[model samples]
Target: MPPASLPPLPLSTAAGYQARHLLVLPGDVLVDEVETLAVSRFAGARWDVVPAGVEPATVAPRTAAPGEPGVLRTSRHTTLTGPFAPGPGLPPGSAMVFDVVTPRERGEAAFPGSGDRDGLGRAFPAGLPEKEERRAVDWLVEAARRLGGSIAVDVPSSGAPGIVLTPDPGVAVDMTLYSDVWLEPDAAQAVLGQVDGRIRLAMDGVDWQGPPAGIADKPLYRGEQMDPAVRKQIHAAADDVDIAALTSGEPLDGYGLLLDLGVDGMIAVEIGDEPDLPFLLRGLPWAAGGAVSYRVRWEPDDLAASQDEFPPMEYTVARKRSAGIVAALAKALHGAVGGEIADEAGFLVEPDDL
Candidate 1:
C-alpha cells in the first residue's frame, strides 16, 4: 500500500503551537547573522529580531519619596509579566541559556546580592533606539495574534531587554538580547521577514527525508577458512556500502569508514536483547542524516526477558511526542532564520508531551 499523506495542522491547532514562534535578539552582527541562518531552516512560525539587551520586565522599584534626599522609597512598577501569568496557556520548561559580554564589562563588580552571578553589569556606551524597540514589540504582538497566541515583554532593573510569548497553555517563549547598541528598524524587519518566509517552507515539508534502505551487503563477514579470492570478492561486493560484522562473544562494534561516502540514512544491527537497542541507538547521531532505523538479533530466552522489560505503550507515546516536537521546532526555526535547516541543538524539547 502507498504511504498515507501527511495531515496539515493549522497554526491554531498545532500540537506545540506555542513553541513555533521564535524570537532572536543577537547583539553582535556576526552572531546574529549565524543564528538567523540557523533558525531560518526550521521555519519558525513567527520570528522577531531586536537589540540584544531587551528582556521581559520583572518587579522594579516604582519611585522614591518626594523631598527625601538619598532615601529611596519603593513602589510597584507595572510590567507586562503581571498580566501574563503562568497558566495552561503558558507551560513551564527549562532551556540552556547563553549570554555575551564585552571586554570592558568582563570585570564589572556585581550587585551585592545579585541572584545571577554570571550576569555582568558594565554600562556599555551604545545608544538605545526606542523606535526600533517598539517596532519589534509590534511585530511580536501581530505574530502572536496570527498564531492565536499572546506576547509578553520584560524590562529588568539591570537594564536588559526580554521578549516572551504565551502562545497556549503550559508553554512560555522567552528570549534576551545583549548588544552594543539597538538594531535599526530596517535590519530588524529584514531579519523578521526572512524568518517568516522560512517558517512557511518548513510547514510545507521542505526538510524531511524518507526512511533509508536496509543494509546493502550480506555474509556479514568472511571467515579465515574462506578462500582469499572469495573474501576479496565479498569485500568488493560490499564496496561503497554499509555492512555489519559481528563476533559471538565480542560486544558488537563496527565503523563506517569510507571516503566521500554519501549516506542517505543509517541503521545499527546488533546481536543482543531488544531492550538494549534503545540505549545503542542513543549513541548514534540520529540528527546528522536523513533517516535512522535499528535492527537487533536476540536469543529466544533473551527475547522473552526483553519483551517484559520493554514498555511498548510508553515507547509509542514518546515516539509520537518526539516527532511532533521535531516538526514544530523545525518549522519554527525555519521561519525565524529565513528557510535554513537548523542544527540538532535548536530542537531542545518535545513540545507536545511537555
Candidate 2:
C-alpha cells in the first residue's frame, strides 16, 4: 500500500480522520436489526446508527475506480463492497465486515474533526444477506418457477407488495403478469381508478420509451408518441387537438390484475419491431417506502457488450419479502442473460444491487 498511517476505516476519507474509522470492512457476513411497521416499510426504510459527527445524510457512495472491485450500493452514500470480493485484511467468505474505526466522540473535538464532509463516514462493507434479503431470494425463485412452469398462472408473492411506478402516465400495465408489461394508452388509463391510493412505482426515468404503434396511437397528449415528421406538418397547419376530449373514452377491463393481486414490483414492457434484441438493465432504486425498481434497456454498449447478454423479457412480482423480490428478479434476469451485461464501468454494480 501507500501509507502505514491510514486507519482501518474513515468517515470523510478525504479528511482522513478515523472519526470512528470508516473502512468498507473488506468483507461480508457482518451482522445486525429491528422494529415493526407497515409492509410498505417492512424491511428497507430504516435508520443507520452513525456517530454524531458522522452524518449519514452527507455521505456519498465511493467505489474503487473502474477495473476495480464492484460497489455494493445500499443507498446514496452508503455503498460498499459486496461479499464476493472482500478487501485487504478481510478473510475470504467473510459474510460481514469484522471492524474498522477505533475512535469517535459525540460533541466538538478539541483537535477539531469538523465540517459537513458532504457525506457520512465511508460505508461499511456488506456481509451476507439479512434474513429479509434471503427470504426475498427464495420467494422470487419459487414465484419464477411457478410462473415459468406449467402451473400456467400468475402467482402473487404474499405480503405487502412493494410497488414501483413511473413518472410518465402513458405506461399501462398488464395485470395478469407480475412485471412491467406496457399497455396501449387506453389500457394504461384504465387501471388508474383501480390503483387509487396504491403506492406509485417511482423510477429514475431511463428505462422508459415511447409505446409501439397500436399502443401509442391516438396520442395521450401533444408530443406523446407523436412522430417528429408528423408534428412538423401539424405545426405548419396551426392546429390544436383537444387531447383530453380525444382520450376520454370507456376504460378497458382485466388490466387491473397486477394491482388487484397486489405484487411487490411490476415491469411493464413494450416490444420493438425487431424480433430478438440485446439490452441493458440498469439502476436499482430501493425507494424510501421500500420498493425496488430497475431499468431494462435493449441497446448494447458500443465497445463493451458482454459475452453473456441480458435477458429479453419484462416481469413483475408481489411477494412475502422484497429480498425475495429483488433476489428473484436478479436471479431470473441473471439466468436469462446467461452471464453478465457489461456496463460502461465494466464492473457489474447493478447486478449486485439486489
In model 1, state the lDDT of residue 69: 11
Clashes of each: 50, 47
lDDT (10s digit) by residue, model 2, range 187-294: 332333233333233223464233344532355486687686675666534323444434568453222111222333433322112211121222222111222122
Q: Model 2, stretches more than 4 Å misplaced?
A: 1-21, 26-323, 333-354
**Per-model C-alpha RMSD:** 25.3, 21.3
lDDT of every model, 2 decimals: 0.25, 0.25
Model 1 per-residue lDDT tens digits across residues 50-133: 223222122223322222111111111100111111222222331111121111112234344333211112211132113323
The lDDT of model 2 is 0.25
Alpha-carbon lDDT of model 1: 0.25
Candidate with top TM-score is 2
